[model samples]
Target: MSSSTPAAPITGAAPSSLCAREPHVPAERLVAEMVPPPRFDSVRFSTYIPDPNQPSQTEAVQVLETFAAGLGGAHATGAGRRGFFGFGRAAKAPKAPSGPRGVYLDGGYGVGKTHLLASLWHATPAAPELKAFGTFVELTNLVGALGFQQTVKTLSGHRLLCIDEFELDDPGDTVLVSTLLGKLVEAGVALAATSNTLPGKLGEGRFAAADFLREIQGLSAHFRTLRIDGEDYRHRGLPEAPAPYADEQVTRAAHATEGASLDAFPELLAHLAKVHPSRYGALTDGVKAVCLTGVVPVPDQSTALRLVVLADRLYDREVPVLASGVPFDELFSEEMLKGGYRKKYFRAISRLTALARDAKRLVR
Candidate 1:
């Protein structure tokens, strides 16, 4: 027979010790802390500076307002319900005029489509239960995690769903999105989405002959498409490039930054693949300055996804990246565009271009 182990004496402060009590926090304050407003904290309409050169930009902002007004209703308080859930005096006020139920904000890379979508969400005042904001990639990822029907049912409660980077890179994703969009609309959910290509122009150059076009056609009808056109915002006022950095530097021991350089593209990718994002981010924490070489077209979907994470980290930290094998704009090959993560690729390209451009400018 085994003897039961005696419990150890409680060695820490007594339960009734004066230090044991947390400072008195009001119950109301505690409840408030538990629930917060939907994200998109960075984008606000008030800060969107209209490019004096592009008259269309002013119109784009107006479209964003209409999208926000539709779901938020008028006189909605707390920066369009982005803050506290409290129903203010205006909550009793009569509803404002409703606006468009569906809006598609289209533009080329770096043209601020995402900024507009974010602004609309932050400026709208849907009830806390009736609003959500996320990217197309995130939606697909969530569907993968929770299953399609469950995700749809969970999201259906929201009156407004703001999406960024609506892409059609895979037939499966197209089917899923079609079903989801159709159900959302049928349930009275308003959509405000941003994309690099117009609805009719989606899946071009990649799945041009795919049968999913029929579904896209049906979904497209729900949105009032608006093209926000201009030069690629990334290319404006960029610094000149220096001579290409040699690839041999990356093969050296200790991965020296003698030239303040980056590792070979393949090696960098291999390292990135082995770690999770938080660790990957920590690894690159000190990589404020580096040059990238052998930057050929992205080889595969997995690599492209890894590169997206790398690009996001680098961009957030304002790291300087120089390159050689390929231009930043041509980072992905035509073949890679057909993959399900094309939206991530597009985002990677935009971010890398901006990072490289800014890095050069800072160098000069």
Candidate 2:
């Protein structure tokens, strides 16, 4: 031990030997230990499924690489040596691009847009202080729970923010999200987002294009919009899976067998609203399977929205859903399907159609 090191403090629980060893530990190792691991450690570029047939695949790769470079700070170029000592002098620090640039990935459902966003989030070398990843719903929920300004304050600490499923369905959401993105960009937070809709056409059939455009005007200015063209990967040949529920037999539980059915009428919407949007991606929770009997028309816009969130969760988790009321397609009225939120409904249909096809019926 260094002579300058002080005697270790005595504690009842900790041994004197252990306390004494702390002084011997290197400061550099301690500093390294203090640095936390990346928040979205599970996502990475290597896990992204790339297709050579997709023309946008190359552009996507370049975008991620360049974004990563920007996060790491550009490397200084050519160096000239000095006279007498001939010691190499450090080059000037390259000026970082002025403001954070965002990338918006637009594509059809299940075209791996979210996967690419995750890859970018994972591959980017961001400081722990400057990174966060959340679905658009989750982030909106965050804003709802925490006021817009507070949410901005919390997220602005990060240099990069990655959002999945970035769609503007609600009028209020259009305003809130537009403001949030503007604030984030102003705060120098780079954004990477995945969505099923393009910028100019967002909230198209539901709200006035002028209003929606005004909302996203700031985002449109800074974000480089890229279109990802591909077929729906989730719609491929599906296997015949077992039923989500059974006949007349009734139960209040979430997951049930062939002889037992789970009530879907009043409870499904309740359950959907009960969970946090951040958890909407995994709303099934403890259930191994799910079946809904007494399925009826989704009455209001709020309920339809809740169902949209639920369907997204079930589809992402590959949870099968069984219904008894209206056909899955008719669950939402034609008006609702043609309304402003139709994009969400369309996505739900795409997913539910696949789920229903694979779902089994319980034998009486």
Candidate 3:
């Protein structure tokens, strides 16, 4: 496969290498790609099969449906008043809604929070352009790429904004996103987010929770917390992840499979450092599967976090991960897993395991 190309065809030839590709995502593409990823593109409240044992799952759906309905009424009645931007100065902004302006779905790795969040996005009555959905990392990256004020101006027009895997790992990001969301709420944008941590407890282990809370107090107050408890739906009754395949087997599968990328795990990790995390999604564009050899535990916190982002993008695209060496569970060190970023590492493991399961057929 040619290293110059972004992706190669499946022609029983040597597969493309992720390490060889550096994707450049234009700012507009970032904004345009803010909708739910392909995996949850069609998820809706009706399609979400809530665990019969978890009543909060069912309640979340009902509340979100009502929330969607409320947005419909507001949009229908106020459409004419707000010009092109929902918060134009021609008309005085209506009083901000009383009570929480958003819903925060707090739970573990796979309780279908994302499914429900996307369902709410799909349920909202506004046009597709009027609703935005993206991960916390993506949101922060957007602000970084577009500048803070511009991001606020761009999203302030939306009727609903759904943020998945909301992160409080960085103090700066917490303050930035909090202030941005506060602006959007004042403009009447309905907010919804899903996270492993609750609103009040966002930065508990990662940083000083007290300072984080103080910075985001106004934004947190706008969110109504909904706790959904359940086991990871992905692995609820599934068998344990298959053992890593041999390097030769992974390489052979890469050569035999169409639209696959072959890379040494360490080489790919090094390549990730050269490219911005915001472009990770674009890096996998047109790639059907990922095959990595010599997979081992990540060396440090920064690398592990980068791997988590890559794992997320690959999972979002439903790309099967064929890897040799360590299993997904061992990617992070024990200390790393017990640290503040534990939830992220665990979520990455769960997602990568699911993708690994998908790759089993490729090897066969």
Candidate 4:
């Protein structure tokens, strides 16, 4: 058996002398000082945890953590200080996980796939860490904006990554994703992802029903694959959208400040929210930015209140807006009313449409 000793104090006093060096650590501090987190700086350690405080992407953040922690040798127990992401070191470093490490999370719309993917992103630790982006288009879009080499470097830059809602419904995206994944995975990055499809099935226009399978297999081979099967947690039905609209707030807020006409929209919204300090869920695109005010499917909400008010005010002031959504003017007609809940739905839809009518002068 080995014995442990307290660290000596920083004082210059000699050990065992009159001012004999006091133990470096106080008895009170010993408990904390005794435990070192399981992983080192190079390797991250994490466990499944509820989303913390306020999140930029609520569901996505939590789901991602659960997936990455699943990769751990032993489920991470709450312990000492963890690395930046809190993911423990790989049972083995750099080596891929046994069986499969990739998860194919597919289901009806509304399942927390995005949330799961986001959590995985938070749990990953890359050198500079890979940049986390939403949607499949973003993967290749990065290639377009930064070029293939830089994109590969970005993925290589971080060993951990999560791509939210991957697999676009386009052949162009398919080609880019097919190519991008091969290079990114080959570059030594570990990826945990979520999609709306089963393994081998890619969402591309006119894809070789069979070759699509090959394309996925190509990527899946680079990492292990698991299907996150379950029901869609996202609420959906034959009618009206959800309120305060937790999901739509992000989407619509994106529409509010997008484009050249509303150049001052961001500052105006920020200043307007000075007293309240609202979380408008702004999405950053390098230098370009878009707030989520106008992205909501249903316009009634206090969530993106500031942005919506601004969008409405902008329209009143003749600030041309351009976006894509079924304007309430058209969406809530007698044809739509035939479907029902016209009262509550119409109020929200009309408000959103009014913003569109004001901001998007040129049919968004």
Candidate 5:
């Protein structure tokens, strides 16, 4: 952009020549640094994404636009746009704009639900009532630890939530989701989420069970549903490009920011709990690097481990971890990974992505 700017010296050239460089610089870090930390203060976080999910972000916008317009039936949405992310269509039921409870994206795995949700969250800034939550499944972990009623009370305070993993694994879980969602809508909290199942898709697929539908009915009454179908994205692997927001980046940033005075996770978690009821319980090592706080209980295990995992991941260029809860744990019990860490990773990304975007500006 600026031709007048001095060109960078050729590699292996004399060191003292580069003004941006100093007398004593680590050989490793000296190699072409990340654009010299930018001039003037920048967003507390880094904005120089090696590669951004622009295409994905664009598709997400289209999905939200369709949903926002009430393009399909009010309640039931027809399969409209199909892309790398998943399926999207406008719904018409409830007779209300998608604004009431936000847009609910429901469908099978390998669909671009999370990608779509991220797009919607980033673009729908005009609707202040539409608060985009990073993940919905994490709320479940909290609900299991804390009573659901209180969690609802907290979340009802917010206007919107962008939740991922909408399906409830436990039956008791369904009731909590039902009650919490019902109250939120009554109190005017619009909602949105990306899921691998349909509204009544949670319960037994065997009979298209009635009870599941009933529970989903109350919540469904206030919001609309969209189904994504077609070939699973997983059938094909992702292409290489700009580095993704790796858990490592989050952990690295968190660690880099560690010190006497800093914005801690407590505040972030509390805000989240007030919006969603599922985050709870705490780990023994109060030294956790990351965590979702402000729930009835706390997080299980130590919050630090998630940070550690993220920290290790931060250095890895292959799989970038954009967002994370805690960067403390590197090793997830095989069970945790199989059960829902897969789901949790997406949740982390959604959360971090929101946090990063919400910031005034990104720094080195």
Candidate 6:
């Protein structure tokens, strides 16, 4: 629960509240927003700073650059120019390229896999509309919203599809995406994905990928996995996150900053439950900063996972977060930290810590 006392209200501008938003994202908007989020919007291969000690990082860049080059001319146009939802007249399907149809980046978090992935999205010789980049969750959500067949029809004409943070925890999602990818591959679409787990090693602790070996094997055959080894780059040499601010300070900062959303942490979590996870990005639309009071450890797994999605969306939009109470690192319980979703929790902490640091400038 948050503190009872409220901070003094601002004189001029009023702060927005995330708890007040219940964004409704239409299917067309979902299709449009599939491109890279703001954080990586302009990131190109040249911008990636590889760790000199990690040779594989550089090797990945070289291999991906060649891979992008190979997808030139005929591959880029994808048989013919198609409008949104595959409306344009179709031409003969291009000859499917021999060898691997895609690249899979297998590495630990903060190893620049996403940066490399987005760079490949940018480097590929295709118009922005012809290439798509999004998180694995977003991809699944699109399927849920548009239906599997509609999704295939929508993306099959695309030259490339890049998925980040590919998850293998849910056996259903693993199988669903595997079948989806098979259809897309056969349509001559190139693919690239980033994940902490290797394709063959997916679903190790949670569910057995071997149970669906035929589907998993078909998906794996399309990708040439590149192993990148490195430490978490976000904290490589950065200072520790600034300590949490007082509740009054956070609220005051929120009111003073334009386009900021102020909310009690618990209340915000409750609000998230009512909104679909697919609309999380839309929920944060135009929110320049996020301010919360009574920040505490998440109550349960479901709530914690929702927070992870929200954190990813906020980080994608480069929205700084100002908060009071427990630090981001302590938001998950010890048992939860050691559980199957630890990577997600850790990634959330890393991103939230960075955003917290960004919020420091907003404090008086």
| Whole-model lDDT per candidate | 0.60, 0.61, 0.87, 0.39, 0.40, 0.86
Residues 132-168 of candidate 6: C-alpha lDDT, one tens digit per residue: 9999999999999999999999999888999999877
User: For each candidate, what TM-score against the reference?
Assistant: 0.64, 0.69, 0.91, 0.43, 0.42, 0.90
Each model's backbone clash number: 2, 4, 1, 41, 56, 0
Q: How should the candidates be ordered by TM-score, best one leading? A: 3, 6, 2, 1, 4, 5
| Candidate 5 TM-score, C-alpha based | 0.42
lDDT of 2: 0.61
Where model 6 places Cα greater than 4 Å from the true spot, the runs are 1-12, 76-98, 208-210
How well is each residue in 1-364 modelled by candidate 2, as lDDT tens digits? 6779773442222111111111222322222222112222364666655566887866776767666556554221223211111113332433223333578888887777766776776666666545676667767767766677778887776667877778776678888888888777655567788787777677777666675676766556656787887777666445633333433432322223422224456565765565554455433443334556777788888888888877776766666565655567677899988777887888887778777665554233
Which numbered prediction scores highest in TM-score against the true structure?
Answer: 3
Cα lDDT of model 1 overall?
A: 0.60
Q: What would the TM-score be for candidate 4 when compared with the true structure?
A: 0.43
Q: For model 4, how many clashes?
A: 41
**1 versus 5: better lDDT goes to:** 1
For residues 177-268, what per-residue lDDT tens digits would candidate 1 score against the true structure? 88988777655567778887788767666565357778877667667788887766666666543444444432221133332444567667
Residue ranges of candidate 5 with Cα displaced over 4 Å:
1-63, 66-102, 126-132, 144-149, 205-213, 230-364
lDDT of 4 by residue, 1-364 (tens): 6588864433221111111111222222211211111111122223323224424234444444565554434222223211223345433343433344344555433344444554454454332223343434334445665666766665554445566445544456665676777665544345656655554655433345455566666665544344444332322222333222232333333333334222232233345545221111112112122222223233223323344333322322233333433333443346334322232233334434444433332222
**Clashing residue pairs in candidate 2 (N, C-alpha, C atoms within 3 angstroms):** 130-158, 130-159, 206-340, 243-360
Give the Å shift of residue 47 in candidate 3: 1.0
Error of 2 at 129 (Å): 6.5
lDDT, candidate 1, residue 290?
52
